[model samples]
Target: MSFFAGIKAKWNAKMDKVLKIGDFDKQLTEIIADGVVTNNELETIKRLIQEYGLTEKDLNIVGVKAFRAAFKAMMSDNIITQQEESDLLAIKDILCVQNELVTKEMAVLLEHQELRNIQNGILPVIETGGILLQRDEQVHFLLDCSLREERVVRRSYQGGSQGVSVRVAKGVSFRVGQHKGRMVSERDVVVVDTGNLAVTNKRIMFLGSQKSFDVIYKQLIGYQVYSNGLDVHTSTGKTRQIIFDNKQFKADVLQLILDRVTIQ
Candidate 1:
């Protein structure tokens, strides 16, 4: 190929990529125009992300914009209803937004839902994950946060020294040695795993990378709310701390649980 032809071809490709970005943004804006995304629209979003002209980074940029726009549209009224919340979640998942990336805004949305629920004596009903829900069980958001569990670890320390052995008799010898260190219990706060933390009308469920469990509202004996997380105690004498990036989210979850526990 001629040098000029090669240069022109490369330029055309670059221009096409830029054009694809504009097209992707326009499509996304339209999809989220009504503040909701339909199941059929998912394919369109996915196709745009996978467009051959754009790079992975470019797709993500477009997707993030759409994701944020969806959030704003749905919550424009300062409230995200059950269906709108589902739609928002769908957009997030399709856009591949990690839980940590969404901590702040999602926390705010949950707070909105919780406050609204209080006014009407309603619990935010949501689709449950993995664990089978019992009768009357309704789940809220599946939070992406750190789960902390207490565990016992043994550490050894030197307590004594060894002495030289000497021959005391023809057939016997005397030897001296130092004693071993004593074992002591030490408590530490560590992150066991990270994953979705869902609160329900009856329980607090966590599905994590290395750990998963549930604490029922009835079994929830007490909880201490912190700026970044929560320490919950269950009737079974188990204590777990769930950590979030935002203080407001911690308060929101605590408040929602407090309200739910009263009537459960």
Candidate 2:
């Protein structure tokens, strides 16, 4: 068996034992590592077959250079984000433990991205191209070339009391109304029996300062204000309100949202 095949064989056996013991977190971590290994191995196999005209015999010759070149291409094309690169490098560390050819220095270099280390470094160019995966105090970024900030505006229809929602991206939709869009504004209000309404915490926190706004709005639920020529209040600490004023930005966000929301 090849190195990966051998690893899989052992992994499967270990999985059986772990399942019996029910070490879920450990098992999940192993599964994620295995998935990365499988994906990389499949990619390597595809390249070898299409370009080098090699067979199974060449698996032993697979080196870090091939992986590095493929990864570099993906980065240039914006296929994978920096966090993904870090995950792949972590997988490589595990792989290196099994193979003597994979070196420590190379793994470190692969894991590190100077551009990602500094905030606002890559934002100006690809602001709407990524997702910030929150983990503890650190942020893990992932890019979705299919969606952009200008194309993810949140919209609330004129006559709806069902709260606001974001427009969906083309070819990407989850449920009936779970489309990913930008936050515009939110407010808190009290409904009385005499057809009177009291509005509070009206606030607008654009996409750029979303995290900070979310933090502050969670505590300012009683204040009210105007947003996009409409009156509203920041009533809920759970949901975010977003709006886009720029014509082109609104147009793009609406088109992408409609593309995802239209009934098939």
Candidate 3:
């Protein structure tokens, strides 16, 4: 018999022998140190719990610790495989863990998976509620973003006199040949709309409250990645950008743009 099996046999043979809760927790900690909780280990834990008269509630602390260890182990490489995800979900089912964390982590993991799928050419045309997609196009990232673009506004300083003039009399002034009044055509960055910024296999699309655009990969001249957003340039003489203020999928979006989109 194996070591744990032999220990179980001996403990079973001794009728008066009992296992302590702390000892059980320590054993569980050791088992989860490798970031994997095997089926046999789980079974052994269940049997030990029954044999020692310990409730699942009593093991809550150790269970959460084990789950966290497994989660960290999966995240150490920055990618959560299907098996690792399965392991975490299993642990969550067995333990009373925080639901919010699992939900958020699962979402991020799904996004990671979608990005991978895009790279592998196994894309899916998912149904998005806020925007419409063309046939055979797949969206890898769709997020709420604020659209900002350069606009020409003939700006003029109005609080004070900005006209070039010459003093002719005590209280009256003679204006110069042509007083432009400080008005000039200058481009200013302004938030024009709120919308969904979507990166797809074929194009980058923006469906906004006040505007919408679709720029195909062939039209892309260049792109820029920021700490919180992305900007794409097209060859159509018009440039626009959107700010999402989120860092979660920035890398994935950048990778997608770099991979399929042709930069001129």
Candidate 4:
């Protein structure tokens, strides 16, 4: 038993030395998370990664796991107390932001590269030499803005049995009022303030009537620019033609966005 215990202890000591996190590892990750590290530290890490051919994706995944392990060790070793758990959780949230940003950048890069490849390889073949191709192929343009489904609460002029009469703005607004309030003139009812509103975005596709429009939408989606529905403004006037398949309540904007974009 004593001989076996000695062998196990020796193995553990050897493994710990090889797998320990060093100053370079923590410093590099801190800089990656925040830019506080000196420019030289940033360059050093960048150079080492470049020399070793390591990618951002590789670092993020590895860093997440390493930090999680470190956090666990800190927890177990009394390095961090119970009150510090919230602080660690907040750090984890910051790490999540980094993860999301890295993912978004990768997606944007891949999508743009794909678009370039398609324009180089497929577009010319279709435009110049493909069969049944015409000089004026009725160039159809599609504009895909980020259109998300939203709920617009409408207040009725008359109160019901419950005495609930208020409008809930779907988009961020400037007006804040209670459900039970005296009726004010239309002019007095201002748009809700952007600060105190319950506006949220959902991931969805928007379609306009053109190809260039579609490309724009793709770029906006990659960049996270989105809207609740179609906001079409022309030289003469502005019109919103939100397409929906609902047979009833076609006049309502909220219903239209929900019908066209969201699953009922």
Predicted structure with the largest lDDT when compared to the true one: 1
- Say which prediction, candidate 1 or candidate 4, comes out ahead on TM-score: 1
- Any runs in candidate 3 off by more than 4 Å, and if so which? 1-19, 36-47, 50-53, 94-124, 128-135, 138-140, 153-186, 245-264
Tens-digit lDDT string for candidate 4 (1-264): 599999999999756533433443565456444312344643565565555444454455455654455354444543343333433344444333264534533343344343344333322111222222234432111222322223344534544234434456766444344355454333332222111101112222233232111221112221211233333323333222333322321123232332322221
The local lDDT score (0 to 100) that residue 56 gets in candidate 3 is: 62
Q: How do the residues 40-84 of candidate 2 rate in per-residue lDDT, one tens digit apiece?
A: 654544443445333333333333433444345445544355655
TM-score for each candidate, following the candidate numbering: 0.49, 0.19, 0.64, 0.28
- Model 3: per-residue Cα lDDT over 1-264, one tens digit each: 899999988888554333466787677678667777778876776777677666666666566776777677778888776677777777766655666746666676677677666566655455677666677766766778889988885666544444578988899987766533444577888899988888777788888878988888888887887767777888987778778765554666466545654432
The number of the candidate with the highest TM-score is 3
lDDT of each: 0.75, 0.35, 0.71, 0.36
In angstroms, the error of model 4 at 94 is 21
| lDDT for 251 (candidate 3) | 60
Candidate 2: stretches off by over 4 Å: 1-60, 78-80, 94-112, 120-264
Candidate 4 wrongly placed segments (more than 4 Å)? 1-10, 13-15, 22-24, 36-43, 46-62, 65-105, 108-226, 236-240, 243-264
Give the poorly placed runs of model 1, Cα more than 4 Å off.
1-116, 128-131, 152-154, 164-177, 184-187, 246-250
Indicate the worst ten consecutive residues by lDDT in candidate 3: 255-264
lDDT of 4 at 92: 42
Looking at candidate 4, what is the lDDT of residue 6?
A: 95
